[model samples]
Target: MSVPAVETAPLLNTPLYDLHLRLGARMVPFAGYAMPVQYPAGLLKEHLHTRAAAGLFDVSHMGQVALRAADVTEAARALEALVPADILGLKPGRQRYGLLTDARGGILDDLMVANLGDRLVLVVNAANKAADLAHLRAGLPDSVAVEELPRALLALQGPGAEAALARLAPEVAAMRFMDARVFDILGAACLVTRSGYTGEDGFEISTPEDAAAPIAEALLADPAVLPIGLGARDSLRLEAGLCLHGSDIDTTTSPVEAGLGWAISPARRRGGARPGGFPGAERILAEMEAGPARRRVGLLPEGRVPVRAGAALFAEGGETAIGHVTSGGFGPSLGAPVAMGYLPAGLAASGTRVFAEVRGQRLAAAVAPLPFVPAGFKRG
Candidate 1:
């Protein structure tokens, strides 16, 4: 995902900023907000702890918008005009992931759409929220209203997330992946989704800004939950083979090239009932059928040396470049260095050997299946 640069201007703080500081977090500027990069426990420990238990993340930096029309059908149809996803098919109380694409098929941002019974709630990247809102207003029918929610979002993620959250809200225990519901926790009303970026069984909670800190503290009070920061958050998502908007995908990168075709529902594809009306449909659909020139793939470096983003990749023994790493680092869960980048389609298959040029030296690497660590989502 495209992380906004740390600008020279003043930075904003989330509702949990004081709580993070109190917990001994190291704060840094991210996407115009002063965010916690890590706490006293460090990224490595935070990563492992989340996998074994639960991790509480302050994601108030994300944008939340409520899209309402005459009804759910109208709202979904209006949204479908901007994205390739089959929003109309999204059942109430469930969510689906999608990308906002420009006319040229390049990604503007990726987002999650949750059907909230009366209205559709969209959670978009903080950096692109403003643009995304404008895009929605311009493309959607006037009957559909786009209102940004002044809410704070938090992510409670990991294998123990369900249990930990259950302690406060038992109803959350029955929520499956992508399920959404409104419940009261610590006297605060929240829209909680059984979804997260960690590729784990988790929930993303949206609550009023005023109540965010209290709810977060309540969750952290559980033994299974610990505060995590952006550092571990990045490493965790990278290990799950999840793309970061600005780094792995951007306005120059199409969904097909990013290996996110799964986000395009069958109903939006050619020959389906609602085929190809969204932006860049022609080019995107063509690429989907003919295949993209370059495809994102997982890279496993041969040794201990970590290949970071922007590292050049070359064909075995050939100096000419084929692709570049978009996200890379040591995966705490895998206990090895893992990276993901784009490569020519033919060179993207698992077991395909490539070389990464690091520090003027070429190191052997292999194209491996994505999610170096298997995803633990509770799909059932």
Candidate 2:
């Protein structure tokens, strides 16, 4: 007997697309979805609003997957073996950021993992979702079940995020940073965690795909919450000293070189001890001890000129190219040109003077500590 041809389904839209259109959002294609790049209110206002008050962002494009195993301990072990983070030490209801690597130690993608009772949940970047799923499935045992959560994820972030979310989800008022819990908002159940990529005290709410419209409408009904776009999201994270997957760091960069060695635990670093599985162990462990030849650093431009990605950095003489900018832009919070790039280890000091070639002109720049704006996460 002949088998029937399977029909391919069209790309799914988030429940908020209609609302986005009604709000005059300039829709763009991103991660296989029609998303808003900016709205009628514009990007600058959105960026400033997010820093000063609350900005609601739809990050539902990110992949949400859960790993189910026999028990928590075994699940943690299996996961720890794959990533460098100390998952075994992760307390219940807490989350940690980690990277997945290939055998040669190249990054597959950076992700956030949460200990959700007996199962572990992961939120990975949208661009690398397919590759990440393939990587996970190949590495994990057959007994472990992987379930993808196709839902809308929203982030209400800024200094005033807690106050805004509390108006709708009162239980979030007492939630601690990195803690996850199930809460009801406007009569709809959702997974809310006091976490964000903007280095602020915020909440990431995962709601049913179908209920996204109602849930967003309920929260946005508040006067304080405004819709933000990707343009502002990049600037906000950059100002917060966060890394962008393909830009600031990529498959070519190791955690050590990316200045993320803190993600590795002591148990994983002990001499002669086998750290859990993933990829690039020998080189990664070695770089952890000896340090990387090039390190990611923060830069401040001297003049009114703003440096951009791929701009070449030079030593004091401005003749020899030493490094290049990965992510760069005018930081609205800093009110100046702030950027991040990889430079030779020797020149990666706080006070080291450097130069960047922008528009054929060499501009004086200095190495500055990351997080041009201080993080205001509500730790308690």
Candidate 3:
């Protein structure tokens, strides 16, 4: 479905607001809309539930756009020129996550692009939608049509997500991570993808805006699927070692520095030797080989005091500032405080002792391996 030309508020309201409220969701402002931060079940319960079963999330505010041309080959080249990912090698029905670079090669936004049977579908951060669309429209050839899907996106994430989705569409069971298809889900024609920001085995369903509520209701009817608010979503993704846009990464950062070098394909890296594709290509390519000055690293706080974003990470004596926390919270699954931040490369090794200055006191912390919780993504 084509998106309506309606002007949306910075705080856009999702079709599930009423249902979220009915379920006693704690509403908060996010991405220009009032959204549930947590449901009555609280963040702890919701976090655990999603890790153990299925957690339904309303992520419709995310921008869903399609770029189409007469042929997939032309479309792929145009996209590959803008993103570092191996878009040209993407098979039909498979998706790849990548970053949009500024002329200088700094990351503008992290996005997911899929080779739909006929076109390329892009899912981007809601906060960067307008700019992202403008960037694509400007860079893509005139022949390509950039259409934003008028749909409400839902995510059924966790270990039990497959079982919950199969109750409605058994075909979902066969999809591997990052594979998407237009399928009938709960009687509604929707796009279902086996992917999510959370590193769990899950599916993101994009239903026609109006049919969203009904499909969401149907999914929740199953005892295994519970409403998950943004709070839990943030925590879950953090535990999964996923970066949050605008925080962990932004225009000032490059994918290599953000620990997203895997997103760049060998073709792009080799292309860098010639140095002429997108913004920041020169610097980004150089960093790919020499390494970033500062890198995003995971930190495990020693005590229960949850270190919040913006907390300062200090060197041994807690005098020299080494890094700043970007995303931090209580990892319900890990049963401890976990955080991700950018630190000088010299201080980013595992087991390196660091201190986080929380309010007034210094809390002991250590450089830790990411995905504090194991990722359950379907590899095959």
TM-scores for all candidates: the values are 0.97, 0.94, 0.95
- lDDT of candidate 3 at residue 313, scale 0 to 100: 89
Give per-residue CA lDDT, model 2, range 1-380, as digits (tens): 99999985555566788989988999888877788888888888888888888889988989999888888767787777689878878888888888887777778789998987888889999989888888888788877777787778998998888988888878888888889888878777888888998877788999988888887777678788899888889889999989999998788888888888887766677463446455788888889888889999999999778899999999977678999999999888878989999999988999899999988888998999988888889896
Off by over 4 Å in 1: 1-7
Highest lDDT model number: 1
Off by over 4 Å in 2: 1-12, 271-276
* lDDT of model 1, residue 156: 95
Q: How accurate locally, in lDDT, is each candidate?
A: 0.94, 0.85, 0.88
At residue 240, give the lDDT of candidate 1: 91
Candidate 1 lDDT by residue in tens digits, 241-332: 99999999998899999999999899999988899999999999999999999999999999998999999999988979999999999999
Candidate 3 vs. true structure, TM-score: 0.95
Top candidate by TM-score: 1
The CA lDDT at 243 in model 3 is: 89
Per-residue lDDT, model 1, residue 229, is 98
Tens digits of per-residue lDDT, candidate 3, 152-219, equal 99999999999988988989999999998888875678888899977789999989888899888888
Candidate 3 segments exceeding 4 Å error: 1-10, 271-276
Candidate 1 CA-lDDT value: 0.94
